[model samples]
Every structure is written in C-alpha cells, then in structure tokens.
Target: MFTRIQAQVLGALGVVVVLGALTLFLVPASEPAPAPVAQPAPEVVDVPEEVPFVTHQVVGTSREGRTIEVYTYGTGTRDILLVGGIHGGYEWNSVLLAYEMMDYFEAHPTAIPADVTVHIVPVLNPDGLAQVVSGEGRFTPDAVRTDVPLGTGRFNAAGVDLNRNFGCKWQPESSWRGTRVSAGTAAFSEPEAAALREYVLAHMPESVVFWHSKAGAVFASECHEGVLPETKTLMQTYADAAGYKPILTFDAYPVTGDAEGWLASIGIPAITVEFHTHESMDWAENLAGVTALLARP
Candidate 1:
C-alpha cells in the first residue's frame, strides 16, 4: 500500500542493518587479560656471628672526643698490656704493630695461653694520630702522610707532650733530647694521661709494654723506686728473642714524667720497647719477643 519511494527507503534501511550484522560476525572480540600470578616470599638470611674470645672496649676519649680503645684477647686473669702510639703520628708504626698483634691473636685465638690475657691499647694519643693519619679507630700504612715533619704530630692537641704528662718526676718543662717541651700544667693534667692512669688503676695488669721507635732497644723503667726485678727479666727476655739490646736506663736524654717511670712508681713492671726505626714495624723480631713473653712461667 506504500508508495514506490517509501518502499525503496525501507528496503535500503533493512540492507544497512544486515550489513552491520555481517561486520559484527566477521570481527572477533578481544580476550580478557590473564589473571595475575602470586609470587613466593623472599628468602631470609642469617647475620654472621661475632668472633669468639675477642673483645673491644672504649676505655676513654681523647681531648677532641676521639675514643681511646682497647682490644682484649683471651679470658685469663694474668693480664699483660701492650700499648702503642703514645706519641701519636710520630710513632704511627707502633700503632700499626699493635694492630698487627691484634690481627694475629684474632686469627689464632688458641695462641694465647689459657691462663693469660693480653690487652692492647692501639693508640693512646688519637688526636695527635689524626693530625698525621686520616681516619678513626683503625687505619693502614697508606693512610699515613710521608711528607709530615719528624716531630710534627708528637704532642697532644693542647701542645703538651703526653709522655711527659705522667705522675713520676713530673716537671713544668721536660726535655726530649736537648729541646724543652711542656709536660702539662700538672701530673695527669692531660686527659689522655688521665685516661691511662684510670685504666691502669682499675685493672692492674701483671706487666706492661710500651712500643716506641728509633732507639732499637728495650729499656727498663724506674722512678725513685729503681727498676722492678721483674722488669729487668722482661727486658732481657724480649731483647734476647727480638735481637734488641736490653738497656737498664734511657740516658740519651733526660725524660721526666714518662709513662713507664710512673708505672714503676706504682710498683707495676713496665718496659719501653723502641723499634729500629720510625718507619718499619720489624714484625718478625717483635713477634718472636711477644711469643717468648707469652711462653714464660
């Protein structure tokens, strides 16, 4: 009943709808993304345990607040103290030697006798040591400066000679060779000396050894009370083993308020073991000496 033009329009519309359906059938729909997979938990790791029979402590602090450290090996009551770097950077080799001993003991814990304990003070004058070596607590040879003067870093930050700041025969001015150096305002005036004093009083070790340099000998200590009988025996034992000369006294110069002398005043047997030179540690010789001492009765 419709007109020809109306019928033609309806047929065209129907043809367009059929073409749309054919296109929908030809093109495929996109697949949904795969579901995310869960991950397994990460593995946990255990921290390494601390080394056995080896202990470290901060006995005191330097003038500039640097820690004065002590490393103790073994658990025996007969304590033997080995000190180095009392002169700071001037005797930096001593510090190196002390550290070497620590390394050795750490590696061979059984090397120390069951009845003996060894305490090592690596550097007593940390401020002076820092003036020459860059770092804190521990350092290596390369950390030291070669161009520094011989006596540049020998004194504490307060310009006092720490070796002369002890209590025995203390003077306002002390001599190192022919040159006069300040011994601090009073005995134990410097904090470094005070720290050492406190440590010694608190824990009186059976004997003490202070490593120094350029003398190539081991000298016995005395302050009014004369050298302790045991000190002479210790000097001889170390000297014989290390090939160093055992001297009764240090007369190259008059040293007042020396740490060894102060120790002698208090009846503690102590010796100053001077190395061959300021640069070399002479490890073999020192090791022999230390071994001999440890083996003693």
Candidate 2:
C-alpha cells in the first residue's frame, strides 16, 4: 500500500531502529567507567633566598665588656677604616651616622667599590655611650643630659678620654673644651683604645676616618712628624663633597694621643669629620663625603 519513496523511507527507519537496539544491548553503558577518577594537577612555587651584605667580627670589647662590633664591607685588597662614636655619648650622632652608613651598604651593596674594603666600628666606647643614652643602639637627642658638665660624657666609664689614650704623643692628660681631661695612665691604656690599636696594627688600614661633632669642618690628621700628604688630599675631598670647611689643623684645642694622630703617625692618612651639630647625624653631608671618598681612585 505504500508508494516507492515512502517504502524506502520506512525501510531506512527500520534499519536505524535495529542498529539503535543492537548498540544499546552490545555497548552495556557500565556506569560510564566510574567517571575516570579526576586527578588534581601538581603545584609549583618559586622562592627567593636572602643575600647578606657584610661580615661582622668581634674585634674587641668595650670597657664595660660590651661587644665592639667591626663590620666589614667588600673583600677588596685596599682597606679603609671608618670609626664612629670615639667620643661616645658626647658624639652619639656619630654612632647613629655610622649605623646609617652600614644600613646604606646593606641596602645597596652595589654602591661599594670593587677595589675597596670598608670596615666600620660603630661604637668604640659603649660605656660612655651608655652614660648619655639609656637604650643600647638608638636614643633621641632628648636622652642627652645637657645639665651635666660639658666633658663629663666625653670620657669613658674608667674616666679616661678615649681619643686621648692612643699611642701618639700620648700624655697623662689631655684637654677638651678648655677643660683638662685624663688621657689614661699611658698610651693605649683603656681597653677600648688598646682594642682599636691592636686592630689597626694588625690591619694597617690605608686610610682612617673618625666621626666627631660640632666642629663644622673636616680636619686632616697630623702627628709630630707632620700631615701625611694623602691626608691633605682626603681632607679636601671630603670637605668639598660635603660642603664643609677643610681645615689643615685642629688648633681649637691642643690634643694629645689622638686616635687620628696615631693613624697619621703610622703613615696612614687619617681625617676627623666633625658634624655641624651634636643633635643630628648630619647624614646627607656625611653620606656625600663617604661617597666621594669611596669614589677616589
């Protein structure tokens, strides 16, 4: 009863139904093979390691038995020693300035020259520092007791002017701000002075810089022999860079057994960088001067 085209269509539909039935019976769904058990991807993470800038060594101890830390920056052959707080609490800003310098190097290790090694002794007289500043590392200007006699905080716990206890034209006494100060029994008499002396003798640094305050000038170091020619150049260099006056001699007061003078006596160029005030570290000027010194060929 069907036409030719209709019969062909019906026969195709019948074959498709038979195939669908065979597929359903033969395939056997099998619960989709347990959904193939999805797995988690492996994770990857990256971490950076920390880099150290300087090496610290306990070269000596203070009079109060506190550690006098010497931080060494760079391993270059030519060495320079930068000392701060030799005057202790009287020049506490010097210690802060030295710490600032250390921090700069730690932050920008590349700023240091390849051929130079810089050693910094932040506090040479911890006892004297303790006299003025109560805290260990940092203290504000208000912490200083100006009520005390001017030079009372300048001397160490043993009552000796550390700057005047070095082995150069050393005397039993020295002068500070028109007041007579004890220079210890002899040269290198105090433990602090002895420690610095031993370290200097052992290392024989090419140049030495001592930070001081309230002079507003950069003074070249000299001994009985006279100023080292290199000292004159260095003085000019720092003074020019820092916008400070370059002084050939410190005639403000007669000093004996001075640390800088001792370095000069041993043929090393030495300088004392005096800040304009005691309250501030004068960080910018000193940092400029330090950069200029390091840039020297």
Candidate 3:
C-alpha cells in the first residue's frame, strides 16, 4: 500500500543502521603513536693528536721494490742524515735504535735542537730485513731469527753487500771478516746503495751517521785521500757523550767501499757508531750520543 519513494527511503535507513552498529565495535580505535625510539648514543671515538716534529716520507725504493721510509724531524737547513740497517737484518738492532730515536724526537719535539733537522732511514735494506723478520711494518726482537748466522742476513736479494757497495774505493769484492763478500758489479751498483747515493747528493747533509753492531767503538770516515777534519770532531762528540772509545781507523780489517768513507769522499762528515753487541740496542748510550750530536753548532 506504500508508495515506491517511501519504500526506497525505508530500505536506505535499514542499511545505515546496520553499518553504524558494525563500525561502533568491529573497527579498533587507532593505537597511540609509537613511543619515540631512543636512538643509541653516538659512538665516541678518541683520535690521537699528531706530534709537530714527526714527518714521515718515502725517500726511495729497495731492491725488491719495497718503500724505504724516512722520518724527518724539524725544518732546519742544517740537515743531519742518520741511517740504520745498512747491513740489513744482520744488524737489526741498529734499526731498532733508529726507531727509538725517531719516537723520542716525536714525543719531545723540543729535544731536537732548533738549528738541526734529523732524517732517519730506519731500514735501508728491506729485502734483507724481510728475510729475518716475519711480518711487515714494526717488528720486535723476538721477530728476528735467532738461529741465522751473523752473515746470513747481510746481503740484499741481489746478493750484494750494501755496506760495501758505496763509491769510495769500491771493488768487485770486499772482505768482511776475511769472508770476501761481493761488493757489487760497481760502485752504487745495487739499487739500495744507489738510492742512498742519490739522496746524499741531493740533500748534501751537513753530517751523516751510519749505525752498525759489535764494534764497540765510534769511528770517523776517511776516503783514499784522507779523513775530513770535521770527521774527528763528530767522532769525538758522539764518543764523549756515549762513553765509547773514538777510533780514527777500523783496524779490524781494511774496509773498502764503506758508506762513511763515501760520505767523506763527497766532503760530508760521517761517523760509524757501532754498538757493543748485536742483541742489545744500547739505547741509553746511543741516545746520549744522538742528543749530543743534535745540540752541536
């Protein structure tokens, strides 16, 4: 009996009532916003400050193409070149001593005299050092091969005795304890020796010091011509400070193509500060010696 319009309105009202009832309970209310996640505290890392005196550089390459690093201290024009391990791992203690000196200069920048610049080549013969040391970079006393002979680690990969490869009175063969080691085909023939020669020529350092072992004396360098007058002063200076006997000549045997001698040949004062033993660095003595050298005018 109802009209079509009235029937349609009644149907729409019934659908709205059902939908409202479902929405009132079936839809869960939105949950409160997630509690802000606490971000982890940013990691705090401490970096070490660089020392003013420390400046590391690669001066040259070794026979096996290993980098020969130099640690230079100070910016003075009166440069002093200090070399260690020229005989390679056979005299590793010398290299250790050189490293100790570098560390000292870095920590105590004021310890180095204002007018002096110190250049330290800790290991000149890398291939030979590798033969005795197991790992790369810094090494300890235990890293050395104890059973190796005294002369075992003396030569480079090219079988050249670097100490005898300099240009001073050079020969094809040189005697080390009468053993007759190969000096090289010619003066500065080996890459290690050549690199050192080039560096010495370029820098023309005011003085040079080569550290060795088991000699128990400080020695002045002399070419075939004769010893430089300044060589005596350097030898005495180091010796007086370190309490070692200063000897003008290496009377143990005739040494040819010696590094110090080559320095003398070029008119640079050079000294061989040989430690008493192969095992010990003689740190205190050498340190005093170096400190004295740095304080020189």
- Model 2 per-residue lDDT tens digits across residues 1-297: 999999999999999999999977887677453567678787676665532458988888877888888998886777889999898888888988988899898888788898888899998988888888877765667777776665446788889999999988899988987789999998988999998988889899888899999889999988888998999999999999998999998898899999999998889999999999987899899889988998898
Give the C-alpha miss distance for residue 49 in model 1, angstroms. Answer: 18
lDDT of 3 at 25: 63
Tell me the lDDT of candidate 1.
Answer: 0.91
At residue 204, candidate 2 shows an lDDT of 92
Q: Model 1 compared with the native: what TM-score?
A: 0.81
lDDT of each: 0.91, 0.87, 0.88
> Each candidate's TM vs. the true structure?
0.81, 0.79, 0.81
RMSD of each: 20.5, 14.9, 19.2
| Per-residue C-alpha lDDT of model 1 across residues 1-297, encoded as one tens digit per residue | 999999999999999999999977776666544678978788787876654588899998888999898899988888889999999999999999999999999999888998888999999998999999977768999999888888878899998999999999999999998899999999999999998999999889888999999799999999998889999999999999999999998898899999999999998999999999998998999999888888788
Q: Specify the highest-lDDT model's number.
A: 1
The residue-level lDDT of candidate 1 at 110 comes to: 86
lDDT of 3 by residue, 1-297 (tens): 979999999999999999999977676678654799999999898876654566888877887888888889987778999999998888899989988888888888888787888999999998888888878888889899877776667899888899899988999998898788999999988888888888889889999999999788999989977878899999999999998889998878878898998999989999999999988999999999988898888
Listed per model in order, the count of residue pairs whose N, CA or C atoms clash below 3 Å is 0, 0, 0
**Candidate 2 RMSD to the real structure:** 14.9
Q: Which residue pairs show backbone clashes in model 1? A: none
Model 3: runs farther than 4 Å from truth? Answer: 1-52
